[model samples]
Every structure is written in C-alpha cells, then in structure tokens.
Target: MAKELLKGNEAIAEAAIRSGLEAYFGYPITPQTELLEWLSRRMPELGRTFLQAESELAAINMVYGAACTGARVMTSSSSPGISLMMEGISYIAGTEIPVVLVDVMRGGPGLGNIAPAQGDYNQIVHGGGHGDFHPIVLAPASVQESIDLTVEAFDLADKYRAIVVVLIDGSIGQMMEPAELPPMQPIQKRNQEWAVTGAKDRERRILSSIYIDPEDEEVINFRLLERWNEIEANELRYKEYFMEDAELVVIGFGTAGRVALSAVRAARSEGIPVGLLRPITVSPFPYARIKEQTELACGMLVVEMNSGQMLQDVLAAVGGKIPVEFYGRMGGVVPLPDEILAEIRRLCYEPVAPSANPRISWMNRMNITKN
Candidate 1:
C-alpha cells in the first residue's frame, strides 16, 4: 500500500504475485534473476508454486502445463534464454493458452552482455516462434510501469486466451526506484471448460495444437487472425509529449522512449519544435496515431538500442509521407540524452548531404569525441 524503493525485476515479480499468479516457473538469468529469486521465497510463503527449471526450455513447458490447468501462470528470462523458450511459446499459442511472460531484455543476436538493450523488438513482437500468431507485447519504461504492466499482462492474457509479454530492458530490471505497489488481488482460479483436470464429474476435455486435417487447421488460423484484428483495432496505445505545434516527433519505446523524453525537453528549451511519441503497446503498434503525427510534423526520428528493429515499423507507419531517420546504440550501450538531442537538431535544423543514409548514426566515434 505504501510507496517503497524496489528494483525493477523485484517490483515486477511482486506485482505478478499480487495479480493472483498461481504458479511461476523460471530459470535465473542476468537482469531477470531477481524476479526468479524473489518469487522463490515469496511463492512458498504465499502457498503458491515457484520453480527453478533445469533450463529455459523446461521452465516454459512447466508454464504451459500450469496454464493448461486453468491457473494464472508466469515465467521470465533475458534474451538468449527467451530464445530457448520460443518453441514452447509457439506451442502455447497454438493451443490458445493464456499465460504471462516477462522479458528483461539484454544485448544480442547471442550472449552479448548483462547490460540493457532493445534488440528483442522483432523477436518478441513479430512472432519469435513458428505460425502466424502474435503475442500482446507491453513495453514499460519505468520501475512503476514494469509493475503496472505486469499486472495488466495477466488480465489481458486471460481475457484473450493468448500469451502476453511484459517487455522491459536490462536497465529497468537492474535499477532501483520508488513504486507504489498495487493492492493484493484476491486469488481466483480461471474456469476453462477445456482445462485438463482429470475427468471427474464432467467428461474429459481434449486440448492440443494438432488439428491433423488441413481444413481444420485453416479454420483455426483464420479464427486466430480474426482475434488479432480485434486486438489491433482496440488495443493500440501510445502517449504523446508536447506535440502541439511541433515540427519533429521523436519515437521510441521501453527504455529508449524514456531517454527520448529527456532529449525532447532539451530540444524544446532551445526553440526546436520537437516532441516525443512513446508506444506503450509494442505489438499492434500505434500505426494510425503515428500517421496522424507524420501529417503534422516535418519529419520523425526513431531512437532505439538496436540497429533498426522498430525503425522499420515507424517507416511503415509513415509510408513515405515524411522523411524518417534513425539513431541507435547497440551492444548494451544506452544513448545519452545529448546524443538523441543532437540527432533531433540534425533532423529539424541542420542541413546534410542528400547522399547520406536516411538513418543517421549519431553515436559514431567522432561525434562521441565531440560530445
């Protein structure tokens, strides 16, 4: 009830418990190890299930099993670990099981480092696993947001009978900040007639992704897309910061979005008409909202900790209506506010050679030296 200081991972784990999580199966990994560690003690004290699986694969399957029992379940890991769970995630989606997954992203196409990075954007949002399924991805920018989204992930998962991902970067997972914990939710088990509780009073309900007939599989795929359309139409979310009378809009999500806000404020003080557009829901991204801003602004700059993952999404959103540029910091390095501000200046005020890449690299060694 009272405000207290907590690390982002700890806050998220507590939020999951308060959100009526019945079971959590996770392996310890940097940036997200605290989440598993915290629950290891807390879950037993609360008489709920907590497990340290032999590997990420084992953990996700355990979550699959628990979710099939109509229980609110969760699991967490960092980048490489998450990759290992992709197969199970696909199976979970194929069966239409509701479960929450937390990804405190770190660097890499491989084991890059323990520092924060946003490289998982494509892998998480654009179907990391096989099949034409989409997971609801919520990117939180603060410790409080990490907690808030963790709570929301559970509700959304159950509401749609689909996987929900609470995506935060390594910085948020490792940093400490003040947060107000939500009130403890009363524990309640979900009622799914199809849950695999051994046949007792009712007839046995079958649950499987195997629709052997191609026609049956086609029907199920269409149904899934129909549901996705509903989510895309209804769940698009974003927050605008000082967009009125702005000529340039800076777009980012998760930790990068938070940094972009700082750059926006700095740009405005110098009379550069700049603002920020932060996406809250990464998947079913706010395309319509971004298109509206593109009409009003001269150009847009996309900021991220990856090469150009979300940049492509922004480009698609604008559809060549205005010039779009990109600035990034990869391999666990976070772009400084000034680095972002410099790029905004280039887009709004400075002139550059037309032959240059449309996407600018603001963090080059020369620029870093100047700064």
Candidate 2:
C-alpha cells in the first residue's frame, strides 16, 4: 500500500477497521473524537457495528458486552473519560474477555484541558480498575506507530484473552504523518470455545466476573497472575537509539520519548555518548534493558509529560546502581526537544550525585515550591 498523509486518530480508526474490527462503542472526547467520528461513518458503510454511547461509562460496558461474544471490539477516549470507565474496565479484566482500548490522553486529575499529556501513565499502566488483573499497555510515539499498534492490540487481546490498551498522548492523536496502513483483512467468524455464544446443541457457556466463593476468587486471581507473568516474559518491547557505546541513557515513552530522541541526537552531535530507550510495551516494561544499561551507562535521565510517573519504574529497574535523573512538564505541557537537550548536556558535562529525591531537585530547578 502506498503511504498517505494521515491524521493519527483517523489512521488508527481505519487501521482497526482493516484489522477486522467488528464492533466499536465510544463516546466522543477531545483528541480522540476523530477516531469515533471516522468509525461512525466507516463502520456503517462496511456493515459493522458502530455506537456512540450515552457516556464513557456506557461505552465501556457496551464494549464489554460485545467482547463477550468473541467479536473484535474496541473503544477510544481521553484521560478523564478513561477514568469514568474504570469500574467497567475492572469487570472486563475479571471476566477475561478480549477488548482493545485506545486512550488519547489529555491533561489532569479532573477536567483538565484537551492538550496532550502523559499523566495517564500510572492510571493505565498500573491498574486504575479495582482488580487483580493487569492490562497489556502499548505506547506509540508517532502516527505511524499508532496505526500499527492499533492492529497489534487486537491480536494480543485475543491471543491471551486479555485487555490491550494503546496508550498515546493527545499530541500523537492530533498530529499528521505519512504512513502506510495494512490491507483490509476479511472478518473471520469467531469460534472461541469459551465465548458465550448460543447453546443450540451443546452445553451453555457462562462467563462472568463475579465469584461469590472466596477460594474460587483466589483461584481466578492466581490465573490472572500466571497469565500476567507469561505476558511479562514474552511481550516486553522497546526501541533503543544510539546505545551501542552509550555512557548516558534517556528513558521516556510516547511523545516524551520521541522528543527525547531528538535531544539524544543533538547531544550526540556535541560528542556526548548518550542514547534513548523508548518503551513500546509500558505494562510489560523493559526492566531488563534498563538493568543492562546501568552496567554500561554512567547515568540515566527520565523525561515525561507527567510528574515522574515512569521515573519510578526506571528507578526500580536501576535499583540504585547508577544515578537517575528526572525531567517532566506536567498538566499538558509538552517539553521541547531543546529542553531535553539541555538536560542531556547537564548529565554529560555537569554531573552531580543522584539526589535523594529527583522530583524535589527538578522542582527546585523549575522554581516550583512544593507546599
């Protein structure tokens, strides 16, 4: 297929369609409204199910119901909208149904602006839902990656009967880029043995998240943990840039990571031995890679659009073996490449002992007095 200039939200929507998405249920929210808008028109033309629910809560439950039928189902929303779906998400996780979710994150703990932000990292990566289940989270930095990961989300969701989340910030969702989408795939009839299809000649299959017996619930929890262990083992994905002989490493995801790549390149031009590690699978984080970098790299920098959410993960991976620094612009403030470049320059030339609290140091630098 020839490459075309495509908007990220629309590209992802079409990619899901081409991937044989059978049903979509979502309420329109900023940064991701285009996705639902595109599907509103395309899904009907393709004779697939498309619904605009009353709200995010309704939308997620609709997705949950559709997924139980073993259909390729999806939903998209922004940060606050995602929060509203947490209970439904937990239910889907407990039921062990396959569902794909796209989160075009914007700012805030509340009704923040529609600007791009990575604040949803902890909420989505760690569980916001009340449960003992973990969802597979994929972060994409570019529009092209957004399209590709949308397709991958469905496959992964089905393979393990798990929830797969494509977590991108608002910037990627609103950006435009030249990308090639996969050819349309024919929708395959689902024959999942565990699916709650009609029991015409065979015994009925019951799928529910509720287990009244405590021991039965414990067994379910164990099953979830074992599956999570397998996912962590096989699905960890990341991309390394200029790391062959890197002495300083930068870690970020989505737009922060993409911007950091530019900074790393700038630092390299100035003869700095710096590299970048962008995690594609955030849930199954690339801890092993970070651990390896600790052996070779003198120091590490973590950049994010939130207040050091991923920083904690990197610190755990480093295990205090090397100095770890953090830089962030929260509340929808996207950091510029030059800003990250400056941090890299400091890491390379003006080395300091790792602070007891990196966020405190960062706040001091930013002149924000923590009250």
Question: Which model scores highest in TM-score?
Answer: 2
- Estimate every model's Cα lDDT from 0 to 1: 0.90, 0.94
Question: By TM-score, how accurate is candidate 1?
Answer: 0.96
Q: List the residue pairs that clash in candidate 2.
A: none
Q: How far is candidate 1 from the true structure (C-alpha RMSD, Å)?
A: 2.0
Across 278-353, the per-residue lDDT of candidate 1 in tens digits comes to: 9999998998889998779888889999987898888888888888888888989999999899889888876544
How many clashes show up per model?
0, 0
Candidate 1, residue 170: how far the Cα is off, in Å: 0.7
**Alpha carbon deviation, residue 124, candidate 1 (Å):** 0.4
Alpha-carbon lDDT of model 2: 0.94
TM-score (all chains, Cα) for each model: 0.96, 0.98
lDDT of candidate 1 at residue 371, scale 0 to 100: 81
